[model samples]
Target: MALAIFDLDNTLLAGDSDHAWLEFLSTLGIVDGEELRRANDRYYRDYMNGELDMGDFLRFVLAPMAAHPRRQLDAWHCQYMQERVLPMITDASRALVRKHADAGDTLLIITATNRFVTAPIAVELGVPTLLATEAECDDNGEFTGRSYGIPCFQEGKVERLRQWLGARGLPWEDSLSTAYFYSDSHNDLPLLELVGNPVAVDPDKILLATAQERGWPVLSLHGSCHPVT
Candidate 1:
C-alpha cells in the first residue's frame, strides 16, 4: 500500500485550527481578547508570508496550557472541538480520507500545528498516524510553554518525515509504490516536493501558482472535487 500524507489545517479542515482555538479561548474569556487577537493575527499573517518566527509563536500559543491544569485544558479542548472544529470538517474532506483508506493506503496527517490541537482531529478523521509540532510538558504532565525538537514547519516537515520513515526501517524511494502528499500551504512545499504525488488542496495563491507551474495535480476537497492537471 502507498503512503497517503495529508496536511491538517486548511488542507483537511476548512480553516486554521490553531487560530480558531485561540478565538475559542477568547470567547471563553480565557485570554485577553483584543491583545491576543492582535498578536495572533500578526503571527498568522507572518506565517502565510513565510516569515513566522516559530519560537515566538510557539511560546505564545502554549502559554495558556502551561498556566492551566491538564483537566481544565482538556475540558476546554473538548468544547473547542465541538464548537470550532466540527464546522470546519467538510463531507468532501472526509470522503477524500476514506477514499485513500479504502485503497489500503497508510494514512498520516502531518501538520505544523501543535499536537495538542491536532491530535483529536486526527482521531476524528480516523487517520492512524499524525506528526505535529510537539508541545513540551513538565513531569506533572502539564505543558511548559515551550516546543520540543524540530518545529515541524517548512523544511522541518521533510526532516521529521525522513526520521519517521527511517525509524520504521523504510527506505525513502523503494519501500512504497508512491507517497502522496496533500497540502494547501506553501509552507509545506518542502515535503510536497519530496513526495511522488503532490496534490494541492484548495491551495493558497503561492502554492496554486507553484502547483500549476510544476504540473502537479490541484484538488479542492472543500467542495466538489476540482482537479487541475
Candidate 2:
C-alpha cells in the first residue's frame, strides 16, 4: 500500500493545536496562568523563528500534565477535542484525509506537536498511525515533564520517522515510492523532501518558494491559517 503522511498543526487544522491546547489549559487554572502563558509565548516565538530548543519546549509543554493523573488529563483532552479541536477540523480537512483513506493508503499523522495534544485530532481524521513528540511519564503514570524520544522537528522528523519504520521492519530507504506527505510549514521541509510526493498545503513563504522550485504539488485545505501579523 502507498503511504500518506500529514502534518497536524496548520496543515490539517485551522490553527496550531499545541498553542490552542496551552490556551485551553491556561483557562482551566490548572497550571500557573501567568507563568505558563509567558513561557508559551516565548516558546512560540522561538518556534516561529525556527530556533526552538526541543528539550526545553517539550518540558514546558508537558509540565502541567505532570501534576495531574492520566485519567484526569484524558478527560480534559476529551473536552478539548470537542470544544477546540473539532471546530478546526473543517470539511476540507476531513475530505483531504478521506481522499487518502479511500485510496487505501497507509495513512499517518506525523507532527511535531506532542501526542497528548494531537492524538485526538488524528483519531478524528481517521488516520491509523501517529508519530509525535512523546511525553514521558513516571512510574505512577504521571507525566515527568520530559520527552520520551527524539522531538519530531526539522531534520529530527526524518530521523525519528526512519527509526519508526525500521523498528517495524519496514524497508526504510526504498519506502518513499508512492509516499506522500502534506505539510504547511518550513519546519517540515526535511520530511517533505524525504517523501516521493510532497504536497504544500497552504504553505508559508519559505515552503511555498521551495515547493515551487521543486515542482511539488500545491494544495489548500482552506484559507491561510496564519494569524494577523
Candidate 3:
C-alpha cells in the first residue's frame, strides 16, 4: 500500500504547534515566560532561516516535561489542543487527511516537533502513524528533558523514517512505489526527496523555488481540502 505522509506544522495545520505550545504554557506563568517567549521566537526565526540548532532547540522545548507531573502535563496538553491546536486545524487540512484515509493509504505525520506536543494533533487529524522526535524519561516515568534518539529534523527525518520502517520489518523500496510527502519547509527536503511524490503545500519561498525547479507538484491544504491527485 502507498504511504501518505504529512508534516505537522504549516502544512496540515496553519501554525507551528511547538511554538504555540510554549505560548500556551506561558499563559499559565511558568518559568520566566517573557524570556522563554523571546527564545522561542528567536528559534522560530532560526528555523525559517534554515539555521535550526536541533540539539539546543530540543533541550529548550523538552525541559519543562522533566519538572512537571505526567498527569498535569497531559491535562495542559488537552487544554492546549482545544485552545491552540483545534483552531489552527482548518477544514482543508482535515479534508486532505480524509482523502488519504479514504484512498486506503497509510497516513502518517513525520514532524520534528516532539511527540508530546504533536501526538494528539496526529490523532485529531485521524492519522494513525506519527514519526516524531521522542523525549526520554526517568525510571518513574517522568521526563528527563532529553531527546531519546536522533532529532527528526532535516536529514534526521529521513533516518528516523528508515528506522521506523526497519522496526516494522519493512524496507524503503516497498513504500517507494507511490509514497507521498506533503510539506512546506526546506527543512523537510531530505525526507521529501526520498518519497515518490513530494508535494509542496503552501510552501515557503525556498522550497517553492526548489519544487518549481524539480517539477514537483505544489498544492494548498489550507482553505478547503479538495481531492488532489
Using lDDT as the measure, the top candidate is 1
> Which pairs, if any, clash in model 3?
92-225
> What TM-score, computed on C-alpha atoms, does each candidate reach?
0.96, 0.92, 0.94
Candidate 3 regions with alpha-carbon error over 4 angstroms: 224-229
Clashes of 2: 0
lDDT of 2 by residue, 1-229 (tens): 6888889888889888987887888889876778877987888788767888888887777888887889999999999998899888877888878888888888988888888888788888898899999888788777887887788889988988898889989997678767999999888888888889899998888899999998998888875453211
lDDT of each: 0.90, 0.84, 0.88
lDDT of 3: 0.88
Count of backbone collisions within predicted model 3: 1
User: What ranking emerges by lDDT with the best candidate at the front?
Assistant: 1, 3, 2
Lowest summed lDDT across 10 adjacent residues in model 1 is found at 220-229
Model 1 TM-score, 2 decimals:
0.96
TM-score winner = 1
lDDT of 3 at 139: 88
Candidate 3 lDDT by residue in tens digits, 35-119: 8879988998999899989989998989888889988999999999999999999878888888889989989999999999998
